[model samples]
Target: MSKRYTPREMLEKLISFNTVSDRSNLDLITFVETYLAEYGVTSIRVPDETGTKAALHAHIGPSEDGGVVLSAHTDVVPVKGQAWSQDPFASWVSNGKLYGRGSADMKGFAATVLAKVPDFIAADLQRPIHIALSYDEEVGCFGAPPLVRDMLAKGPRPSFAIVGEPTNMKVVTAHKGIAVYKTTITGHPAHSSQLHRGVSAISAAAKLISWLDAQTADNKAKADPDNAFEPPYTTLHSGVIKGGEAHNITAQHCEFITDFRLLPGDSKEAWLEAYRTFIDSQVLPDMQAISGDCGIEVEELAYVPGLSEEADGLAETEARGLTGDNARHVVVYATEGGIFQEHGVSTVVCGPGSIDQAHQADEFIELVELDRCAAFLDRLIGRLS
Candidate 1:
């Protein structure tokens, strides 16, 4: 962990950590802490309750308010089921792209920012430049809110934040929010032939999933035509389901996870209320009629707010000026940008690499993308100076 490493070298070292969402990111966090310390920058470590994962927040230049924060997530998605041409942890260059885990969906941006530390430290800055990196973002943005709170709570909070989720170095003004929920169904078990004596949990789960499908259709039909989003509406889906024991026995337990992405201004509370109402008034009564102990439990696991177009133009103007791109874009994916924005920091997402390459078997970032990000950071330093 040397300070002399270039952005590409930083990315290579970052990729070697194997910081999958489920694993600890302490090693990467420690490396970043050490790297920043070499330049006389002090970073605050925001540790999670488990004390195994942590987020790093650092500031360089004047310690006053109104600085800009460069944000990125250190954890990457798992490489479990994917087929790769080489060791996923060993980053390598081929053609003009850098290939490895976390190269695009987001360690590249982190590297680019870290690489610019020398320039930022050298500049005669009137305003500070903050670096904020979090863990477990791939797992529903689980690790950023606390980190944001910690930074803001320390006083003289940043004026704006740039969330470096891969966007091919384009300025993104809006993105969808996601709310993940887990539903569990309990019912009596009995022989299939004795259908009247038992309630099938799997049957109940199917009905709930079908209800979600109907909601998805309704959302598509009622989508806002003026919205630039691809689907132009909030979308819902049931992603994982598990239940049942034997073919001849009615299921005694079932569980499924459902999540929905919300367009800006869409309310997940109302959507969840509607689903809860349906279960309580329609599904639950039917289940209770079969068995008094039968029940359905639904709870929200995570909710990441959508980045709204209402953000102040500070970050947007800076990004557009740096990249010379005026075209505004909206994305279906969720990012930590929304969380930053929600906490009163005007935030935008502009980073290297296409998100299409993210979470794939052979994830990569174009070499030019890294170069573009480097140029952007240079301009950012100019702005702070």
Candidate 2:
């Protein structure tokens, strides 16, 4: 007989594995594959080029089109700098909450889905239920596109996809898109006293960062008050920066990472073009004038399209039906739903826990949240049946 685990038990098992974005999630993937195999379900692995990471997908029920997909990422952010009350990889229940690194950010949703696999299998589903687990969602939604591509090619075409991101189980019809970029500034080195002889990469980077800040402020000022997003506008943020050899010398090299979270209807290309124009026409020319070798390079690290609200979308309709949540909701965070939506699948973001609890020290999800999620899945099973 196949062993069955409760949602809590499965959550404990999942939390035991450290699937931090920097580490390989193969152990967790293998465990999921093995567990599904126990129930006679076969899943496909979509491995990255390095084979150190993979995305997994499985289909249950009749092999046919117009199915539903349950999507969630398997990776969690690093807990290195966090001060946790207990081991981040070890699951513990206290005060009606389950605590762990990925509990809220989203292993909670995955655990609930896995625990109910047996139920899904036995539900005599008329339409298939696809399970999609991807990697590296924390760094950026990098792993989802390939995973979605493989799923579309290999399995029954899914009509709807529900991304299990932490949204307090609210049905989210739209979300902001994310574009990550790294800018490297190259300049000539010279003594600080000889400012005119050398281009200071650090100073150039500061100016660029200031430009991004100005854009952010401009967007905020013109934001729509009626928009559902938290800030109701696109946002620009520079997260990491490094460079400079010494205070006495002009820096030869400097680099910084920045990201833009654009509203659903905004054009990422337009923003990129404007930014590049500023660098090429203004910043780069000034640097090169002082030192011929000085230059600026901008590289796109990742890009995730935003989820746009669809007219009577099947995923949103179904999710709203299951949760009885008719309230309009939109998220500022990016999720795999955008990737799925871009591929022509109607997608929505709905899952347990609050985003506030995610990626925090002693991260936890309310036990009641998991219960609510399980109930939602049960309703979903019934709908498919």
Cα misplacement distance, residue 157 of candidate 1 (Å)? 0.8
* TM-score, cand. 1: 0.97
Question: Candidate 1 lDDT, tens digit per residue, 88-197?
Answer: 99999999999999999999999999988988989998899999999899888888999999999985589989999999899999999999999999989999999999
Q: Alpha carbon lDDT of residue 290, candidate 2?
A: 84
lDDT of 1 at 307: 93
Give the poorly placed runs of model 1, Cα more than 4 Å off: none
Task: Give the poorly placed runs of model 2, Cα more than 4 Å off.
Answer: none
**Total backbone collisions, model 2:** 0
Please list the C-alpha lDDT of all candidates, in the order they appear.
0.92, 0.93
